[model samples]
Target chain A: MSKFYSSVTKKIWMSFMGLFLMTFLVVHLSINLLLVFSPTTNLFNEASHFMGTNPFIQLFQWILFAGFVVHIILGLILQIENWVARPKGYRVKAISEESFFSKYMIHTGVIIFIFLAIHFVNFFLVAKGIIGEIPKTLVDGKSVDDMGALVIALFKMPYYVIGYLIALMILGFHLDHGFQSAFQSLGLNHPKYTPFVKGFGHFFAVIITVAFMSIPLIIYFIK
Target chain B: MDLKLKIWRQPSAHADGKFVDYQVHEISKDASFLEMLDILNEELVNKGEDPVAFDHDCREGICGMCSLFINGRPHGPDTAITTCQLHMRRFKDGETVTIEPWRAKPFPVIKDLMVDRSAFDEIIQAGGFVSIATGGVPDANAIPIRKQNADLAMDAAACIGCGACVAACKNASAMLFVSAKVSQFALLPQGKVEAKERVQMMVARMDELGFGNCTNTYACEAECPKEISVTNIARMNREFLVAKLS
Candidate 1:
């Protein structure tokens, strides 16, 4: 059999793509945190402008998009294959001892996808000059797309805040399982370190969710 | 103890199957789960009814033959034991016990609760072995295997090829079974020669047979009669990647 069609190969690629997207989350949360913690300065706007226009970051953005696309496609394929594997349903509903987050990965994943769609249209497209006009502001004495202002404005809306918070919460659930799961898929498990990885996954999930959720709520309530 | 059995009954592979409820009175609490079924079959036979067909061998845990999904659990709610090792004391009096076969596309129900597990045999035939010269018995210490590796390999070797891992999986994945087989050989020096081809071939056969890919939910580990660790799965993944890349 060709290695491309192998289940293990598909899972390995999925792991790589998942880990890549997770790194993007780290970078994203770091920059967005500036919006809440350093609102008075141009740090958030400058960081956002840098991310949007920097040649290296611009080149990496396409790779990032590919990461998202590949992850979703592979996930769907595996899930479909999983469904087909069990054509006959059991008469008695078996009680599963699996983690609640692990069982509904696809559900949480679809919600995250929806959130990403709306999120890209709201910020990414606007910044790219594809949808609405980019709001301009002076960053380091040069006018650039003021992504921070747009983010703050959107967060101020109650509905947007509510939706964003819910999506972030769902994302937390996805990451809680995905983080350690990615490691397992990559065959990186070790008895000495696996527990640590599992713990850190939970910690990472909570941190990302809380940090992202805080920005919007702070913007709406305090800022 | 008296019990109500909701057993799955199908005449043949292509026949329509349904749950047929039967009552057993004064069943000994000390009787094994299979023994309980045996008594029920005896009663049915005496009544001139079709006996519930199932699988069994040594009536012990090692053979991995007895496969009954009792009460939504493979091997009747017991951990680290097969169906034959499960005793009736695990259940309460008058409890309704549900019995079914291992549910997966690869393992089709042959009769009532017995499934044809020849798919596992086919996967094993693909490549689950190390080819060695048959000239002479090699000296035991000549190969010199590490204690740690030997222990781990033995742990992987503990798998009895039962379909419980497949049954318990939400996706009917054979990852735990295949991984255990792969690791049993992959962890040893003798197995090093054909390790690459072994994992690749077994995994391919598994996918071809329509077993699902593992999402790492670990339901297999929970329901495994032998309690095989999922670490073997990670080891198999590592072996597969190394094989593919090199």
Candidate 2:
């Protein structure tokens, strides 16, 4: 039961990483929104180019990767530990409480993990010049790698669009629980303010999911 | 009242258990569930058959000794009472009712309708104590406390060490029980002295003893005979997090 080695500590770590990833989503969703909302394609290209080349962001990209890895690995371990805690189960099962969103956290998380892997292979590697070649486009009279074009091309394909929508939907559903649960795990619950937190969690989940969804729809419909 | 009982009969902790059907005729609905069981045992004994064994003491419900999973709910269909407090009227005449012991890894079946819940005692021993002493004959106002904190602490202390929370939990998590002890101490001035170490040790012991993590299901509150709040659990999560960080 040393400070860092206990289950409670593991929970604190999970909550910390989870909240950090949640904050990252706000920045990511805003950037991706340019693919749909901006009148000119240059905004997306410039945005993607800047994010790709910024040294500070590049350092943060590594921390972001570490965040995903730690959350997923520790999430799996904590899940396994919980399973071991209950070797025997009820004969006549009764579920009197717990919301559906909270109940399926692990399943949705695994889905999100699978989606992240596919997403990085498709876009992140290309943006980093690690996997595939990027098309060239002009932004501000300078030839820039057309990361936005790649996004458009990928979104035009029916399966990619469908998968993107599905993953975002699950992510939305997960955030519905994750936002508040993370706070609660960190012991942030209170009688006066928890309802507000839950409401904000709902709003955040919808906004992020809808924002991500708008990208594919706008790309396929407009261009 | 005539009733068809489907009771789990297990000989020992490691032995296989299953439901055995029995019919009891002409019993009064006024009889408590345990009293009905006594009648059923009398019939079996008279017929040269082995009598069913179940645990009960303080049938008034304070002891928390009776642990039965009756008709898919802990402590029978009645809310806020133990199995011994449930009267046969809750069941219909000629109805088939299923009864089983508390189901959890930490609570192993010892015999018919009884499981070993000593794991609870082990968890309590981990930190469920004040371990502080004040000089005798202190004034009542010596340690002035806020009414709200005192009342909440008393609420958490009302838990009867029942395993219903574990039985009702999907993961068999003892978070309610463990958190009850944590909350009781966390709110009290006396228990606050070693609060950090207390939460750490109790939660660690809980995890080590194979109790599941709390999903905040609130089933523990719903099934608790004493109606303990999951807020204590919220408080425990807060205490555990702060303790870990600070």
Least well predicted 10-residue stretch by lDDT in candidate 2 chain B: B209-218
lDDT by residue (B1-246, candidate 1, tens digit) is 999999999999999999999999999999999889899999999999999999999987899998988878887788889999999999999999999899999999999999999999999999998787635777988788999999999998999998999998999999999999999898898787789999999999999998999999999999898889999999999999999899
Candidate 2 lDDT at B229 equals: 86
Worst window of 10 by summed lDDT in candidate 1 chain A: A1-10
lDDT of 2 by residue, B1-246 (tens): 999999999877788888899999998989999999999999999999888888888888899788888888989898999999899988899999888888777888888888889999998898888787845876889988899999999999899987999998876889889888999989988899989999988998888777777666578899999999877877898898778779
Q: Which candidate number has the best lDDT? A: 1
- For all candidates in order, the CA lDDT equals 0.90, 0.85
Per-residue lDDT of model 2, residues A24-122, tens digit only? 999888888887778777898998889988999989999999998888987887777667766765567675555668777789999999999899899
TM-score of each: 0.98, 0.93
The CAPRI category of model 1 is medium
Instruction: Please report how far candidate 2 places residue A179 from its true position, in Å.
Output: 1.7
Question: Residue B133 of model 2: what lDDT?
Answer: 81
lDDT for position A43 in model 1:
92
Name every residue pair that clashes in candidate 2. Answer: B1-B27
